[model samples]
Target: MRHSRILADVGAALRFYSRIPVPAGAAEDAFAPPNLKRIAYAVPLAGAVIGLAGAAILIGAHALGLPNLVAAILAVLTCVLLTGALHEDGLADTADGFGGGASRLRRLEIMRDSRIGSYGACALVFSLLLRVALLDGLLALSPTRAALALIAAASLSRAAGMLLLEFLPPARADGASAAAGQPGADAAVRSALVGALLATLLIVPSTGVGATLMAIGLSVLALFAMTRLSNRLIGGQTGDVAGAVQQLCEIAFLMGVLIYARPH
Candidate 1:
């Protein structure tokens, strides 16, 4: 019973940050957990739910003989629904911050503004286009493989987000990232290893061990590049940097799939 209550409280925290509304009195203490250990687990669990929804949409679209374009739209829409567009907004804000500002303070100020900028617009478009294109390509493979890939990508990308939080300092004194900064390095490392193991198990059986290795390697490279960029741009990382990492890692995984997955 106590465990259930804790999980509910954690769920409320997740919903709160993700901008999804929960019922009143469901769980009031936002920081009751006071540690991000559960959050590390929660993130991938949420991703799994979102990924399952996306897989269902893809499978349904395919059965209906829907065009790749339509399937892509549905898949993206599913993500939007599940995450409430939280990460997308983060990506846009990060883009505006990095692309428009001359100094760290200016960039941080830009990111805080509600108005979207040209850089944000371009980043959103590119990110969506990349996701859609890669998903469409994946769907061309066997349905089972596509479904597994969706789940793996969603889960692992979120795990990547948690990884950034573990190693990087909060760029801002008070922001979403700071609030999520309760996970210790050990917990983050364990979650990351678990996520990687799950991804490897899922992808290797379907796409071959070679493809799985390639995907994991590319994801690592993407993570390194993103972390370096975050340090250069903001002196460390914020929640936005975590979002950017997830987005880039997802792209890297897709690119790996394209390079390795045999054409149908």
Candidate 2:
């Protein structure tokens, strides 16, 4: 019975994050240790799957001589579908909090609001534009490279979010970050290492020495900035901060790739 309960908890965690719907009463079940592990592990796995899907779409488009614009649009759609637009919501909420709210409490309040604000609107526009541009450039290089880049970016970004969750205190008593805080340190460490290894595999082989170095440098810069931002806002990191970190890291990685690709 105990073992069955653990499995049920794992299923519930998976359903909470995935596109699947959680049935009524599932939330009443206590989160089991195995279930926590499942949730921690599932995050990067899902990102990898999404990345692979995006790569497939890009490759198919290239093979059929589909326009870059069309390929880019499809890739964005793929990401949206796979993640269920969760990260986008985080980005928007973060933007609203930072841009318009004057205090920590106010920021939290603004973030909770479902309606989009001007800051969120602008942030979404810029994020989408940059993602599409970077992805298009990557596709132009090679379908294989594009695929690897997407996979690496998706995995690493989520891993980065996990890292923030592990290190930082949750801002709200009730929220995703607080819920994720239940995971043990050892499990979190293992998850982080796996995510980092996967990201390294994707970037190092195709990017070569200069690009890899640039990516590392940019990743460090992003981490530092995010740490500072997290500290300033709400006294620590929230779920939204984690999402913002991922989004920023994605942009940073793309910028690194672009800079390395630049001609002398």
Candidate 3:
């Protein structure tokens, strides 16, 4: 890819995935960023940027003499704000629809509703608690290691989401996700490869190669489980399903990292 095309792809991915603003004239510029659906391979690049921002907040808090718990909370909040809780909202809606709906159609209906249900609330609460707790533990090990893990988790989780989009057609005829359409296999593989490379960068440096391989194994398994569960519940996938997969992948990635904790 030309350097210009590469930058535009990153810009498009960043614009789609995060609240961060793109260049002032990216839209009207000659480059004209590619469609999001066509550029799934860039998801990991966008995720790495978001992860770095969150890590900065975490490390900054710790440098300021804050408690690890407090620093972890700050980092979590930073991520939520940076991404506008895009994936988190998707996770909540997916949980509400799948947990409370009586039928497949009903589940799809519930997922599209803007209002949150009891199931959604509970899912959000539980997921947030797990993320915060895990981050706190990771931060205790070392700020740098925790930061790298955040990058890996975010990148790989989004990569997993791309896989969901690649393999499963949209559940509904129309929606943001549906309109984007299913991703091609090559696009999905490229996205996943990017995620793997980034995850390896995070793991191989300090923890060794086994840790890198194990984290990928855990993340891919979680992706498979989530994909199966979504298919069973709704007969297909949706944007919410992608979000849920990202959140689940992040958790699984973190869980794997926790197994090799080394405080420094």
Candidate 4:
């Protein structure tokens, strides 16, 4: 039935995107990447869940008398744990490939390597630092705004990844992205629309129309640049590229919020 497929797809998204458990017997069936591609819209929905959990951690940490920096670090650590550092790993791998590898083929080879390199180490370090710094700023400014920003950033960032999947073919024929297959253009667009709608609603209520527009504009531009960078370096997208997009786009979104979501 159509309903069953939707539930299966939701389960698939959670399994792929988070450390959240799926129904025990359904795990294997939910992750047939082909089936997942059909319902890839669930990506943003899964992100919303992950972000809410992280935001809750932030709130609880602050409530327990933690410093803003400490609470922010705990919140980031919670997300890293909950998602099993899924996008973070992709980011580190992409940095290593793009920064350290000399040739396109070599870049792909580096990304596929299991070991982290110097570039990977540096990328992860800065990513954590930037994320914590941004969240700490937001927390100091207004915890409520920070919570909303977390949800919007998480959803919209994944939407940015969906756009890359829509526009770029897999960088390698045998890679995970190629094996999983990309979403159809229409499906990808629809997913993005859903994500944008959610993000806009989350922001506009608190930040007003102007700030909401700024956040969306910044997120799109950042995604665009990341896509072009991937294309120039590796010819197209891979899972690591998508992951990098998610991480950078999320940071951009949060920064946009921090810039524009001030008391009015």
lDDT by candidate, in order shown: 0.76, 0.71, 0.85, 0.85
Worst 10 residues of 2 by lDDT: 29-38
Q: What's the distance in Å from true for residue 160, model 1?
A: 0.5
Task: Give me the runs in candidate 2 sitting further than 4 Å from their true place.
Answer: 1-16, 20-42, 182-185, 261-264
Candidate 1's TM-score reads: 0.89
lDDT of 2 by residue, 1-264 (tens): 276554454455435544544442445553432244555655565566667777788778778889876787788777767667777888888899988999999999898898999999888888888888887887777667667777777766666676677667788888777766645566567656766677677777776667756865686588678878767977777778777877777777766765665322
- Supply candidate 2's per-residue lDDT for 230: 64
List clashing residue pairs in candidate 3: none
TM-score of each: 0.89, 0.83, 0.94, 0.94
lDDT of 4 by residue, 1-264 (tens): 387766666667778778798773434664455443576687887788888898999999988999999999998898889899999999999999999999999999999998999999998999889889999998887888788888888888887888898788899998778877888888788778878898889988877777677778888998899889999999999988899899998888888888886764
Query: Candidate 4, clashing residue pairs?
Result: none
Best-to-worst ranking by TM-score: 3, 4, 1, 2
RMSD of each: 2.8, 4.4, 2.2, 1.9
lDDT of 3 by residue, 91-115 (tens): 9999999999999999999999999
Candidate 4 local Cα displacement, residue 93, angstroms: 0.7
